[model samples]
Target: MPSLTNQDWKDLEDSIKAAALTLGYDEAVWDGNGVLEVEGKDWEELTEEQQKAAEILGMDEDDWDEDDEGLRYEDVDWNKLLPEVKDAAINFGYTEETWEGDGEIEVEDKDWDELTDSEKAAALVLGYTEDTWED
Candidate 1:
């Protein structure tokens, strides 16, 4: 994995934390050892999408070590992982508004490709599209 800038690290942390929370974890903490410690949920009980999110974060249920307090991962491409995490979050009641705050005009004037994933999520949640947003 490439060295993460502070902001990049924060974004990745926030994304995973959000996913964990949506999937019934009470808390998600990075252990400073390339592992994320998640509390308040069992790995076997996660929904398929939630499991997918966990896998994206490098937590493989099949190889989970019962003796460890955290799950390990390496070389994670956070860009690819984020969408899956966001999808899991969305299914569990998180919305773009949850990340971007409540507003009707946030998506306005931004082209579809220029919008961040959260913005696109907001647009979709609000029933708007590339063409329809201008209506």
Candidate 2:
């Protein structure tokens, strides 16, 4: 791919932010250091039934911390989840292909700076961080 100019990078970042917002994310920001920070609804933000379901799936209270950047349905260990929780996750639009052991949850085998805009945005939405891309 051709190198992206600064303006192109800016536009790409803007698009990512727009996508996040359209998807109902609470916050999205590119830190100008190869990291796109995103925050979504935390566990506490979920309904009581949702919290109970998460708990039944082995998630703890600490897992719901706002500082943890909220849960990513794709990162759940399907094999470990209660059958009902798995059903709920699937019903919520998470595919079995997104199960934790199905593939890497974080980007790998590429330098952070080398990632395309779409890749960065996808990783960000999945809760990846700057430390996740460290060599």
Candidate 3:
């Protein structure tokens, strides 16, 4: 068996604290360093209780699996992207509007106040509601 170093003990303690909160065991709390204290229960008794809880939740801590381990973001390739090439690809074949409608001029030349309520609604992506458009 691998002995848990002081850091590992602390990590385990923090994990238990987080689990209790997430699972709504609101009566429980842990010292910042990871010692557990249930609402009316003893902190020293938690080793046993923690195991039983894990068992009831179908976790076999001794059966170390891939999900038990993970890597930190610090180990990632942060600069794998080049921004200049990305911007150029996005500008490919970009077209400007000439309205191309029989009776309507291009949108860029229109006075916003001259448009109808439905047109205003469309302009704001249907976001123009009484509460939102009040200003």
Candidate 4:
């Protein structure tokens, strides 16, 4: 593959942000560094196309397979979430240092209303829903 020019990178970034908004994120902004600010979402919450854009921006490089076309949600190990996201999850009572590797954070007995807005955002990023606690 040919190397991407600066314009190519910018266009790709824009495309990813557009895709994220289309996928239900209220906002998707790149910090021009490695962080992506997606309103009410996290790495786990991102769809495959969204994640691919993140990869291009250099987040979770180890999670991607060079041989594959792109990373799929199903292929991700939830325990391997980005550091910042994981920290938020831990603070939100989603998991601990020894996560269970269930592909989702433990939320079987937690109440959604009890979780603060920030906590709820963390939970949502980890693929939890209001119905998740009920289930």
lDDT per model, in order?
A: 0.45, 0.44, 0.32, 0.46
What stretches of model 3 exceed 4 Å from their correct place?
1-46, 64-67, 72-135
**Model 3: per-residue Cα lDDT over 1-135, one tens digit each:** 122221222455555545545423432112111122332243333466554554443444543221212111111122321233222212321121211122423432445575465445443431222333333
TM-score for candidate 3, residues paired by index: 0.19
Backbone clashes (count) for model 4: 0
Who wins the TM-score comparison?
4
Model 3 C-alpha RMSD to native: 21.1
Query: Compared to the true structure, candidate 1 yields what TM-score?
Result: 0.28
Better of 2 and 4 by lDDT: 4
Q: State model 3's lDDT.
A: 0.32
Q: Looking at model 2, how many pairs of residues clash?
A: 0
Give the TM-scores of the predictions, in the order they appear.
0.28, 0.31, 0.19, 0.34
The pairs that clash in candidate 1 are none
Q: Model 1, 73: alpha-carbon shift in Å? A: 18
Per-residue C-alpha lDDT of model 1 across residues 71-132, encoded as one tens digit per residue:
12112232332454445335434456543435444344567788777766655533345555
Runs off by more than 4 Å, candidate 1: 1-18, 24-41, 63-65, 69-135
- Model 2 segments more than 4 A misplaced: 1-39, 66-111, 122-127
lDDT of model 3 at position 36: 24
